[model samples]
Target chain A: MIEVKDLVRQFKSGDRTIKPVNGVSFELGKGQLASIVGKSGSGKSTLLSLLGALDKPTSGDVVVDGVSLAGLPDGKLTEYRRRDIGFVFQQFNLIPNLSAVDNVMLPMEFADVRKSARAQRAKELLEQVQLDPEKHSRRTNRLSGGEQQRVAIARALANEPKLILADEPTGNLDEQTGEHIIELLSSLSRDHDTTILVVTHDRGLARKADRRFRLHQGQLNEDVTAGR
Target chain B: MSVLARSVGNAFRNKIRTAAVVAVLAVAIGLALSMLVANQAVGAKVQELNASVGTTLTVNPAGGQGFEGGGEPLTAAEAATAAAVPNITSVVGTKALRLRTETTTTDTADAAAGAAQPDAGGPGGQAASVTTSLTAAVDAGTLGNRNNTGSGTGTGTTNGTEPARTFTLPITATGTAAEVDSSGKALDITSGTGLGDYSAASTKALVGTTLAEKNNLKVGSTFTIAGKTYTVAGIFDAGTTFGNNAVYLTLAEAQALAETPGELSSMVVTVNSMENVDSTKTALQAALGASKADVTQGQRNLETAVSSLNSVKGISLVAYIAALATAGLIILLIMVMLVRERRREIGVLKAIGARNRTIGLQFVLEALVLVALGSVVGAAIASFASGGIASALVSSNSSTAAGATGQRGPGGGPGGPFGGATQLLTSVTASASPGVIAAGIAAVFAVAIIGALVPALLTARIRPIEVLRGE
Candidate 1:
């Protein structure tokens, strides 16, 4: 579950104020699958970053799972990123040198998981994502886009966080593979009771989510529920 | 991963870069180590030489007015007073007299021929008479006489009518002959005896090897000097020239023979150690200030030469320290470059929730590992190369024109007490002392950490969000 009240995220570019997320506010209940749809430069990624506690809100509050993100120290924020939330980047962001399984196991290492248990858990997560055990051992760069995104999803699941934040997770994949990835993510959310919030430009994918919100000009507005 | 393990992994990732940095540091540290060893070695040698020879100070007569060639001997009272000065050691005084002598044969043929030729009178007659009289006088004293004391022929007559002939030549002698030991004590010889007392017996003497050969004389052989008959008691060796030409006797006998009884030519005072030499000389000079005894030039020259050598050694030490500092600076620069190259990796580690102290520890660990590895290799290389390095330096310093020119004087004297073949080899094989090595390692570690600090602080200040945004 997450909540944001008057969240304002600003950037400075050579003495110009850029309000990427201006006075944005939103809430999502536990086990909710939601989408924030927006066009280019609509502040969708910036809003996600603020909610994920990866960036600070300039003068507003962002509460994730009842912990205030605005006043958290750098060290505690890193801890929040490690244990309370997981991120799936649009580019997959797998360390170039590591194999798919090792990439998935990285967050576990950061979270100080037992070395033996991390390997076993990483194998299970890769299997759940329909990735072959043998292919999981191959370097992430050698994997296809869909396969690499699957490893990223596996990595997000590593610490078993309550919230999964997907920033245009399927943006680089073909339509068929992107549909399959969305189905996988939805199934994973239903099975693990984890909240999934995806920021995307795909209206069809937004239609599949349980609820949707559209980010336009640095603000979020509620959209019709997908099933209704 | 542990900080050390991570650093090692990172180091191996860029093998060529790491090797280059390590090589530069190694060469610098190796040179410093070698120079330090050489400096310590030379210092030890200097100390040993100083201790063995001791400090030498000389005392010459006031105003340099006393002796030009030969003059008043340093008195016994003066020598004793000088021996009492602080750090003054032993003093030995010497007196010399010049004399000439010739060889003789006891054959009757030469004696009869010499006697028959005395009637032929001329300038040669006068010379022949003088020779005969001198020979007779020497024979009376029991000193050996020779037949060919002169380069030219002698006259055959004393007064143009008297038959005069010279049978032998003149030779020199002291009043008595005695055996003296290293401690300056006269050795008593009961049987196969040394020279008897010349004042009482007046019949015995000691002859040097040269004198013995010249006269074909041995122990118990009788000879004459200045109309006194004396028997040879012993044959012995002193040092080189001084020992070869001179004969010795008791002081009393010498005074008696010189016809200056109760007066001495010179009195030699031999002290216990070299530490007493300067004081003894000073005390003796002060005591004999009125007596006007003059110190020798050789003593003064020895002191100046030693002081000059000490000044040279001081300059050498300064040069060694300068070389070490230059090497240290080179090592510091190389380590700084290494730390800068690792900055990105350091940021990544910090972003992964590593503490600032942890990051610092990792960098320090990397530096220590690098330095330790480099030091071992460098020390080995230095030790193996020290001989060539030290010899090259020594030769370069000493083979210059100035050094060559300086070698003409006391530089050719006996090697400084600890400066012979043994000392030179020991210096080349000098070992680093434990304390010096420890301090050197500590210094290297400190410099390396300081070098890494700038990069580490920059890494710690990097924001994760900024870095992840790919800035």
Candidate 2:
């Protein structure tokens, strides 16, 4: 359900114009659990940002569900992000002052979900992500790193977006917690028919995805048989 | 999770800081409200003065200012001519008279001359002394006896064997062509009514409270003036001891008593407005002839008092503006700081698909909540403090003017024809009316909205991608 055609995103660093995402091309079918592995500064997150429509491309286009993001207005792109795409970050960027349930309910509120339904939906999403019910009422800052990551995952699923983007989702966790988070994402994609793309530096995590892509020198190449 | 709920929650994110901001804003808003109240009170007083004493013109006989100046008294025909002048509202003629008890001999004419001069520059100039059987209410003290004895030594002893003789005070009496006194001010009657008809000669007189009390006279009591028995028609409180030691008679009776028929001591001409005072004075003079009459604008003391009141009005207006600005600045600075501190939250909200308008509205709603709290406290402070602040401002400014003009009287000095314009200046009362206070709070809210919007707009410049990437 995603298509990238020669997508290029450029920026000026003093006298040089650097292309973090350059001439990239790829495709992923619906419900596909995919991973993009790269060394530090290899532009793995940049490619994910392009697919998420969080940033515009300098050339070519990113098509998701047959809709081209190339020249879409900022408002329409924000709407696409709010209604059809969700993001999880390495830092688990949950608002520190809000409780875990409130963090999950935020995106639903932005989507204009009915106020009465948001709390119940948020609680169910938190339970689906394996967060304990008691910890759901605690502030995100007071939770452990693994718990915060679980809350972030619940927040991303709030609006039931078709695609999810995870940038270094396990970068701050221990090996065991990181493996559990990856398994949780894989299960969400398989059970809910949701497309998932995780950008990471861990090859072991990358190998667990149905499709594995290696990003080097601003280019992407997929591994045809990874999960099997 | 509504924007309103989030904004309300954010308002109290830092309880101590919120309290501090509200306290500071309350002080600034309170000061602004106080100045606004003072400004309104002074403005009303100015309008009152302009309507009452400010718009009057006095016409005296040419050179009839002092006791020795020689000129023919103003005639009824001249008064009528003045009344016909353009912009002249009404003209009230007055005849000044002084009455002495029959027991007090005129052996001391100099004392009578001093008594004939008005203690507080009445519209009617110098009074002509007349003998009457009515006794004066006030006792002639040492100075009075010294002036009456005609002896520089002031012992009242022409010879060593003669005991000091007692002298009775002379009573100042004015005959008015209207119910008002010579100053064109309505008498504050304490009991009974005014002289029924000013045009006709009647045996009815309005007695001063002090004079009536001293003579054991009440309304309907009888007294004799120039061998003609007159009934006490009214007792009036003139607001001053000197003003209360007098009586009022009809113009015709006073003129006949002075043996000067068809003559008037002076004419108090009311004009339509103070702006027309100078023009009306010129017109009245031209109509009555420069040689026949001299027309002067209201009281000199009134001019000084008005100048001081104008200063008060100006100062209060400026202070009000300054305080309002300070309040606005406080809100602006506090909002800017909040926006800066919450940049991360703004970025996260934007990333979560919150619109720019939603974020801006949140900050504005938060600001309005703070302003509402401040206004409640500020209004309470103003309700209690406005009157005292206004009184202090008027007193200081008017006293400065009075000192600069050196017009404070040692003995009930020369306070224009309306008792004392200086007294009017000191009596200005400032009240914190609800309407005025509400209007002031509305102004503060308006400023606060503008103050909040500036910082809220700054949120638009924050890019979620940039903030997240940096983090």
Give RMSD (Å) of candidate 1 vs. truth. 12.8
DockQ for candidate 2: 0.44
After superposition, which runs of candidate 1 have C-alpha atoms over 4 Å from their true positions? A97-155, A171-184, A202-208, B43-352, B367-373, B399-442
Per-residue lDDT value at A204 in model 1:
69
What TM-score would chain A of each candidate receive against the reference chain A? 0.96, 0.97
lDDT of 2 by residue, A168-208 (tens): 99999999999889889989889998999999887767877
Q: Candidate 1 lDDT, tens digit per residue, B1-471?
A: 334665665455568877876787777666666665656655565565444333433333333321123333334455466566554445432222223232243434344333323222122121111121112122311232232332223334445454354433322334322245222434333224665453343445556666565567667877654345656677655433334344545544444444444333343344344445565555655666744655332233233333433443455456545545554565456545655655544444433334556666666676666677667776776677555665555544443422433433355532433343222323334566656555655655666666556555655665545545542
DockQ of each: 0.14, 0.44
Worst 10 residues of 1 chain A by lDDT: A219-228
Predicted candidate 2 versus true structure: per-residue lDDT over B1-471, tens digit per residue: 777777777778789998999999999899999999999999998888776677787888887752336577788899878878999999999888777655433435334333323332222334666555566777778877776554211113334566466666778788889988777888899999999898888889999998998889999999877667889999999887778888899999887777777878888999887667778787788898888888887575676677788899999999999988898898889989999998877887787687888889999888888888899999989999999999999888866776677676667453445445467788899999999999999999999999899999998887777777753
Give interface RMSD for all predictions: 3.6, 1.3
**Could you give candidate 1's per-residue lDDT for residues A1-228 as a string of tens digits?**
788899888889998999878898888888888998888888887787777776788989978778888888977877887787877878777755467877777778778788789999999999999997889889888999999999989988999988898989889999998998998888877889999999988776787788899888888888864641
Cand. 2 Cα-lDDT: 0.82
